[model samples]
Target: MSAVPAMPAVRVAEGPVRIALVGSPNSGKTTLFNALTGSSARVGNYAGVTVERREGVLTGSHGGVRILDLPGTYALDGETPDEHVVHEVLHGAVPGEPIPDALLVVADATTLRRSLALVHEALALGRPALVVLTMIDEVKARHGRLDPLALSRHLGVQVVGVVGHRGVGLDVLRGFLDDARNWRVARVPTGIADAGARFAWVDRVVHEIGADVLAADTRSDKIDRLLLHPVAGVVVFAAVMVLLFQSIFAWAVPAMDAIDTLFALAADGVRATLPESWLVGLLADGVIAGVGSVVIFLPQILILFTFLHLLQDVGYMARAAFVVDRVMGRVGLQGRSFVPLLSCFACAVPGIMATRTIASPRERLATILVAPFMTCSARLPVYTLLIAAFVPATSVGPVGLQGLVMLGLYVLGATVALTAAKILNSTLLRGRVSVFYMELPPYRWPTMRMLVRQVGQSARAFLRRAGTIILAASVVLWVLLHVPQAAPIAGATPAETARANLEASVAGRLGHAIEPVIAPLGFDWKVGVGLVASLAAREVIVSTLAQIYAVSEGESFRGVLEAIQADIDPRTGRPVFTLPVALALMVFFVFALQCTSTIAVMARETGGWRWPAFAFTSMLLLAWLGSFITYRLARFLA
Candidate 1:
């Protein structure tokens, strides 16, 4: 282990002053950071959703105060990765990170007792310290009295109370931040190195100020009575998820329709204005049709992100995790696994990263292995495309048939993941389930500013994927589908000639080579090609299908799917993409380990390719088996 760096004396810096915000999780530190620096915060490194550190500048007339929002840590000891990062940041041991000149201790006014334990640890670092009491509005609502003057006098550190989200008392906080040079030094209490004594000092300070939890938490408690009930909570979560899926299809129609029409017109204009050539075909068919099919689902992605952010901001997510802890017990896991799996709904990469919080290595490894089975945003385009084509939009009571299908797909994914973890735990990765302890945050109305910022970030990330990975893949597939063009037959009609050309292309041959392997799942050569192409990214399948089905699009929106539904296979004497095939396709997507990035991340997390290889092989076999069963069942019903 490296020697700990000596503490530096507080002095004015040549550059902007740096202040690190240290607090326990859900103490309103993030809200305070947002209040201090709105929309100016930037995340570094891999740009994945599993970010731990953020930096922002509090711009004021006096100067720019750079604020470092470290990962929320319960204590200074490095038991977990988050806490380790906190320890490193404070000690100036993190490479490429400068030592912070001061520390801002943020504590929730409703839960200050345990929070002060963290404060005791932070002040021991000997940096200039400021304690900001967040959620002061809730503190007042409960009729709880807090004397900052008294508290500040006791700790020998300045204290300020502010409702971070509401902008209350920000002026006083800003005034203190502006005069960074003359900030008061925190005096660490003597002979209090022991844990009991440290907290005793904390208790003395709290008692002197009469700071204690009052009755306002009951509002959250009352709401949680139903939201956290063993039976009722699960039901409510299911209903909320169903509504969320319904909104994905219902709320996105107008925007999707507009995008569809715009892309269709653009394609038509390109063909008409530009001369008939391979370049025009490349632009109109390859670029417009291929990319537009996937882009039309952007509205649905935005809606999903909005709902996710809303639930997270409202603090219901923790309750949901708590509710699921029971189910985790039966599966030989714990609520800690559920939190990472919940994150998997966004992306498995982050979900896998979140398993770092799990102390048990075997349990953490199990969580990482099964995380990819959770339905992610990348699967949305594929799911929506097939559901929209096969499932009717008619409502069953208050829910649409399409939405119920979407919800079923999500539930199926999660159910299978849990089952997989159970089997793994019983067999190869068997281990004892670890204890899970989590703090439930008080419910509050989400601010529109924070909502917009979060959704905007997710939206930007989606567009980036569309532009980079999807764009390159589409171009590559287009080249494969169009290369080595066939000569026109003397008596062939345009449709016949186009079909012949497509069949003779490189992609066509490649698909045919794998047709025998996938035929039992009711997929044709074109779908085989799509399955292969989508390995780059799941949404790439929709674009691949768009390019593959560009033969006869009338309006270029739903008309494309209508044409697809109308397609016939001469060999089978049936519609190419029938209901059974669509169902089978969705099932296949639900289980297939097709993402290379996921594979890479899994390898990195597991310390080798051994586990990733095992996961990929197992999931691929399961995908085939699941698809075969769904196809046979649908065919029998038909």
Candidate 2:
């Protein structure tokens, strides 16, 4: 019953030899790929699709060979964009990609019976093949049976068993891969396309080899009973989220202060080394102070991403999604929509793109329209700045009041998003939702290496943005606030003179022009300036305000909180940013469509400017109304 053994090696294409890595989700394919090509991987979007393309050079002196990791798909016949792309890639139909020289079909050892059907599909492609069995350690620990020799014999492909996290069997896999000149195409059987025959072949192989894995692990089952409980699960998730926010404030304070101190010294050093002039002012007040203010929030950002990655790696995120699916249905969204919204907390561009998984256009459109309401990482800088300056640090029971405010803002965004989706479902995008399905991955211990790598990537991305967009905006804002310098008053101090110059300059004039409209929300000209500048990017406001305060204060950077708190209004003879004003500012940011990149992506996803325009119009009005209510209510209560 076995297929024929390998023939002589076929010649690969002239340039770099490409191997396509294919698998179903939770099959340990990502872990295997990461082990095979640690830091050399490159990630980008495919030519015409937003699906992420990840490829990397093979390790162990395999000079020019590249391994491309395709999106995880259960079957080639599925309707999802991921499945379509996989089929296109296999047939060399994609524009920018060539047909792969070989196919590496990865399978979870514990789920081999379910994976054999995918292997059959791969063999039908008539490409050179190497089958990898991941989670082999788990199989052995469960006292299950596996015979790689017999499985390869039946399938007519080379087979290797590996424990990806422990780096077991990797050397052998690499050596086999290094012999690319010797790779042989797998033998394809007759009637391979028949679904019944394909599945029957899988069943026979399992029965003959006794390869069915042990029933789901006892330990995982025991844990799932508690975490998957309808009632207890939500309570535990809520508690975990509260602690995550609390740690962001309590854990990051030392690092944020250190960064602030370092930048202050750097700015002061530049001012002392060079004589006082426009150049010195630009370097000290604009570039250093502006960039430093946003960069100081890096510690908090790192903490946030760490919690996210840890939860994902430990296999808890899927459980959370499962728990939320019930609530999602009440809002008329499919269970598949939960993953995209969950991703929105990181950024909306990818979240909107993820809607391709929903086969129903109406459901997908509704998810896209409301995706911006999720509190993204870009909003963290604004929220942290206002909360630290205005919210007291007193502990409310076990949680700090600052942490409570952060959590409330996040909850507010999500609550509004669901409400909006419910309305959209009932009106503009009315339709029946498709059937929903999700797999809960088994719990595993998170590796420190993966966690560190992910956090490092996040930190680098944040720093890159600071060096580019924020840096440019800071310089421009400096010029607008400094040009046409005011004549020094008779008895004015240096700070007073600088403050007066800023009020008379271009930026100050622009802020004042819009100040009348925002006055009802308790904002002054400086906040007006920040709000206008933030439209470019949500985090830009943090830098904008830092530059405004730096020149107005005419002193070294003494932490953004201290500088913002020191501002006193000449007309009112009182502090500018009181509790009401600060709370209003936070509420405004929660609803604003402040990032242009998000708008552009929305246009791309919706296939025109119409939906993006509508979303912007609605959110803008909501932000203003939300801010007004918050400001007036807070003032009245005070």
Best by lDDT: 2
RMSD to native, candidate 2: 6.4
Regions of candidate 2 where Cα sits further than 4 Å from its true position: 1-12, 190-197, 230-232, 332-411, 421-435, 483-492, 515-526, 534-586, 595-618, 628-638
Q: Pull out the clashing pairs in model 1.
A: none
TM-score versus the correct structure, for each prediction? 0.79, 0.80
Question: Which lDDT tens digits does candidate 1 get at residues 457-517?
Answer: 7677557656665566667766777776888899876655665776678877888998999
List the lowest-lDDT window of 10 residues for candidate 2.
550-559
Q: Residue by residue across 173-281, what tens digits does model 2's lDDT show? A: 9987776545667775756657788888888888888886576687788888999777888898777756765676688789988998999899999999999999999
Model 1 CA deviation exceeding 4 Å by range: 1-12, 45-51, 61-63, 190-194, 212-216, 225-238, 332-412, 423-435, 488-494, 515-526, 536-551, 555-586, 594-618, 625-638
TM-score of 2: 0.80
